[model samples]
Structures are given as structure tokens and as C-alpha cells.
Target: MDTPTQHSERDRSSEPDTGPGERSRSSRTRARIASALSWRRVLGGAVAATVALLLFSSYVVQPFLIPSRSMEPTLRVGDRVLVNKLAYRFGAEPKRGDVVVFDGTGSFVREDLDANPLTGLVHGAAASLGLAEPADTDFVKRVVGVGGDRVVCCDARGRLSVNDVTVDEPYLYPGDTASRAPFDIVVPAGALWMMGDHRSRSRDSRDHLGSPGGGMVPVERVTGRVDWLGWPPARAGSLEGTGAFGGVRTPGGAHG
Candidate 1:
């Protein structure tokens, strides 16, 4: 009984009424998801960058804080220094006059043998601080002898000698004796004899002579060479080896 035009109108009116409302809802949901994903991606990239920087700083170059006056006039308390992690790489060993950092794991830092995990972490962090007692474990010293060199302290003139030549260490602190304790020893093969610039306050190779390794630091234990003093603007400078060593030759070898 309906007219043909009326029937057509009814059919058109029955079509689904999902207009802009449904589309807007869907678009909003999609936008929220995209924003979340973008933020996650950014955070992930930041974390990755942080990890890379830590790795490079830990293994390739390390920042060291001067904890004491042991290396004064060259390095000061609170000073931060950049150590070269690759100085002794590729068949090369530490050389005299080069300032170095080494691990005293067994040399001076005795293990608790029963410390809790937390305690161990604290100790490790303290060592990293580089500013406390027995600093023996985290030492920064100058290389006085390297493998087979005869190193003796205090000649008649109160000077230190290496391989029979009196090394004129102009870096020695004013009014400080080269060494107060008398020492005469032949550096073992693959080991080094080290000392500090501030010889008076530094307890270095001299203090470990009677210990387990005879105070000779193993070449493998050295972390790297202290190349730059980085903190305290007035004291910032490079820790260079005296070309005074250019004339000194390795034992039993022709001078290069």
C-alpha cells in the first residue's frame, strides 16, 4: 500500500548511522597508541646512549679523582684526571716517567672472603671514589722501573737512579727527599717499580717490598696511563713523561 517513492525513502533511512562520531573515536584511540609508542622509542634510545657512554668511559678512558696530596704539584686533591686506557696496549709495556693507575686487588686490598653482596658493592664504590685510606688499592704513581731495570733510591746526593743513571726528576717536590728509605733492587721481568711525585706522603713500591709480590706491580694489572689532569682550572694540564728518558735505553739493548 506504500508508494514506490516512500519505500525508497524508508530503505535509505535504515542505512547504518555510524557517522563522524565513530570515526572520531577510532582516530583518538589510534593517536594515543602512537604517542605511547613514540615515547617508549625515545626512552629506549636514551637508555642505549647512556649505556654506551658508560662502557666507553669505563674501558677506553676512565675519569679518576685525585683523592690526596700524593701527586701534588702535578695532580691535586679533588682534581679529576683522564687516564689513557690504550697506552700499554699491543705488546707495549709501561715506561719510566709515565704516571699509571693499577689494580691492587691482591697487592693491598685484601678480600673479606665473606663479605655480603652489599658490602662488596660499597667497597667497590669506595675504591672508585679514589679519595680514602690505604689509597694503596687505587694508587696513581710514576713508573720508575720497568722490567729488568735496576732501580735504586737516594744516591749520595739524595737522588734516585735507574739503570745506573741518576734520573734528574725535576718533578720532585721542593724540599722533599727523593726517597727516605734506602732501596736497591733489580726489577723483575714483566713487572714495574713505581713511585709517586710527592714521595713524602706516598706509600708506593717502597712500602710493598716485603709483601706478596715484592711490591713489583704486574704489567697486566695496570689500568692505563694518567695522561691529563682535568679538574681545577688553574692546575689543569697534561701529565707528560720527561723527554729526559729519551737517552735512557732498555737494559741490554742499544739506545734507539
Candidate 2:
């Protein structure tokens, strides 16, 4: 019972057998680490993508939804337009006949008493993605006069005149007059006179003549130019600025 080979085999069997248990614990640890890393990568990627999109929308370009029929025949309700934020970022300025979007707080609206900061932020984000209505003070219209230009409605031929030059607005809505309200105002320096194509239904510069800023929108208030209509698939196209104001003369005797 005490033979040398028998004693060696008994000692080998007495030692703890831990190979399988150790291996199982090591495998589980590795799997948990891998799963954690994968989730972190996915979350980081999503956050980065969201930041990039917001930056692009704020600086390079922005999406705007048509809120009303003010610019009908040119833009329709529910249509989405891409505004070029950099259009006026350089030394260039907004010109006549250019369709522009601007903040009309001091010019078009006396005050926005219903604005809520939290709600505005949420609505603004949704609007930037073309999923909701734009801000209450945001407006889109066509430029009729810019900087020291005299704009008059219903000239001898019942057509709007800029700097005494009659403008042939072929973009006006069907059956809409040039302007039912008579107005004669000289645009101040660094200001713009905007109007909607549907003159009858639009309450534009002509409607706010007695309000503050004389219904003239400051150039600094302009957000961007509506460069393209991006929604409704069938109505998508570039919004080309017309040469209708080409013949109009500025105060300095140069063409506007």
C-alpha cells in the first residue's frame, strides 16, 4: 500500500483542479468588456452625427417651411425651402427682387408676447429639420426696394414702381393686383422694402407703414436668401432672382 509509484499518484490527485473554472471566469470577463466598448462606440457616433448636423444647419444652410400663402405661386404652404445663410455673409448685400427670410420683430411685429424660451428652442430645432412651423417673427418675402430707393405702388399703369422704373412682376399670383393699398416711401440706407407676391393676402411692408422702423426691415435682420424649394417633390426648383429691378436706378444713379 506504500509503494513509491502509488504514493506519487495519490499526491497528484490531491492538488486542486482549477483549469476549467479559471477559463470560464476569464471568458465571461472578456465578453462583458467587449459589450461595453461596443455600446460606447455606438453612443459616441450618434452624438457626433447630431452635432455635425446642427452646425451645418445653423451656419451653412437651414431648412424653412412655408407657413402661409403670402408668397403663393412662388412658394406654397407646407413647402420646405433651403435658405442660404452664406449668401450675404461676404461683402455682398441683399439686392432688389431677391426672395429673403428675415426676423420681423421690430418691423413687422411690435412685440411677441406669447414667446416661451423653452418652447421656442424646441420649436426652432424642429423647424430647422423641416418638421414644424418657424418662429412667429420669421417672415419670407421678395425685396422690392433696397437702400435709398423710392418705392411706389400703383403707378400710372397700376404697376409697382421702384425708383420711378415700372417693374413687370410676372411672378405675382393670378388675379392679384400690384397693390390695393397706396403707398409711397423712400427706403432709408441699409434698409429693405419687402412684399409678397400675393399682394392682396399678404400683410407686408405696406401694411406696417405706421409701425416702428417705418415698416422697413433693416439689412441686419435678414437671416438668409431662399435659394431653393426643397420639398413637395414636384415643386422643387431653384428660386432665381429676377431682373425685374434691373432697370431701376439707385440714389447714386447706378442700377440696383
Candidate 3:
């Protein structure tokens, strides 16, 4: 009887030992899982913050690069400017003298008429080649006429005129003609007449006369008003409209 009772006691001790070993291994696995989850949460948070910042910058104040000499003497090639997206948001339309970035996709570039798979591929590859777009492509220019201003080029003394006032464009490039082409048009309401400072080198509203919109940019197509030049420390400055435009008044009963 003593021998059988002793055997039973030994069996019970062995069973308890197995239970502790199994529990120890399970505890280690749970700790590892918790550690992995913590790392996952940390990575997700960082990614979310980065995306939010990009969204804010893109929609509120985007940074744009001057990729061509079309705006030379004002915005040089390779200079980066900051566009204020809110400039026209709060019941304000684009004002004369404000440098702006607009969608020239359909207005100037006919390729925009049809979505080309090739163009998309080329645009994607442009950065790799370090090349600018061909002429009459998307453009960044200054606003000369807004809403109802009558804009004509080459007044009697070779000066651009807005609403019968001769505009002395000091912003015009040194030795650059005010306008090589003669144009006379009453800017349609709800549209803007835009031109580049380097008139000879730029193809702005002057070049798109026969196109669908007749060179007049729709108010809704404007992306934002450019307020500052932020790059090339030497060329950094605010882009103020020439005083010439100040004297010209908006046509009668113009809406703000």
C-alpha cells in the first residue's frame, strides 16, 4: 500500500511541472506579439502625419518652380515661388498685378483636347530628362485684365493699355518690347487677360486667339495667386503689380 501511494504523489508533481513550462512559453509569445503591435502603431502614426502635412501644403500654400524663361526678369528659370491658394477663396477674384499659376492645359496646349497616353508618359519622364515643356504648354503669367478691363497692346508709343490708360510696365524685361503683336479686345466678364513680362518670348493670351476659349482664362481655372518668390536667395522678392496698372479702374459696376 505504501509503494502505490508514493507512485501517485510522484505523478502529481510531474504534471504540475509540465503546466508551468507551457505557461512560461505562452507568456513569452504574447509579449512578442504585443511588441510587434506597438511598432506597427508607431509606424502608422508617422505615415499619417507626413500625409497630412503634404495635403495642407498642396491645398493651402503650394510651392511652384519656374521651369522656363517665359516669366524672365520677374521669375527666373529654376526659381521657386510660393502660391497662396487662399488668395481668391474668400469672395475675392484674381486681381491685376498678381502673378498666378493657371491651368493652361486646354487653353494653350491642344494636347489637352484629348487625353494622350503618350503625353502622360512623357510628362512623367520629363523630370528624369530635365527638360521643359514645348511652347504653348502650361504657363505661369501675370494678370493684366480682370473681369471687364479693356486690354490692348502697343499703344501709340508702344505701351500696353488697360481701359484707355497707358500702362508703363516697369516689370517688362530690360530692353524687351511691351508687345510685339498688336491686340485689342474687351476682356469678357468672368474671365482674365493674362500676359507674360517677357512678351516676345512668352505665348500667353496673344497666342491662343483661335482656340476654344479665345485666350480668356475662366475665373474658375485659376489655381492660385502667386504672392512671393522664395528661391534663389539673390532673386527673392515679392511680385508686386506695376504702378501702371493701379491707375486703370475696373469697368463700371464690376463685382469683386
Using TM-score, give the best candidate's number. Answer: 2
Taking the tens digit of each residue's C-alpha lDDT, what string does model 3 give over 145-197?
A: 88778888786678988888788888888888778889888888889888898
Error of 3 at 96 (Å): 1.5
Candidate numbers, best TM-score first, in rank order: 2, 1, 3
Assess candidate 3 and give its lDDT.
0.77
Q: Which residue pairs in candidate 1 have backbone atoms (N, alpha carbon, C) closer than 3 angstroms, thus clashing?
A: none
The TM-scores of all predictions, comma-separated, are: 0.78, 0.86, 0.74
Give the lDDT ranking, best first.
Answer: 2, 1, 3
Question: How close to the true structure is residue 71 of candidate 2, measured as C-alpha lDDT?
Answer: 98
lDDT of 1 at 203: 81
Candidate 1 wrong stretches, greater than 4 Å: 1-35, 115-136, 233-237
lDDT (Cα) of model 1: 0.78
lDDT of 2 by residue, 1-256 (tens): 5999999999999987769888899899999999999999999999898778778888988999999999988999999999999999997899998999999989998776777889988888888777788988899999998988988888766698988889999889999878998889999999999999998889899989998888999999998999999998887889867888888988777886
Better of 2 and 3 by lDDT: 2
- lDDT at 109 for candidate 3? 67
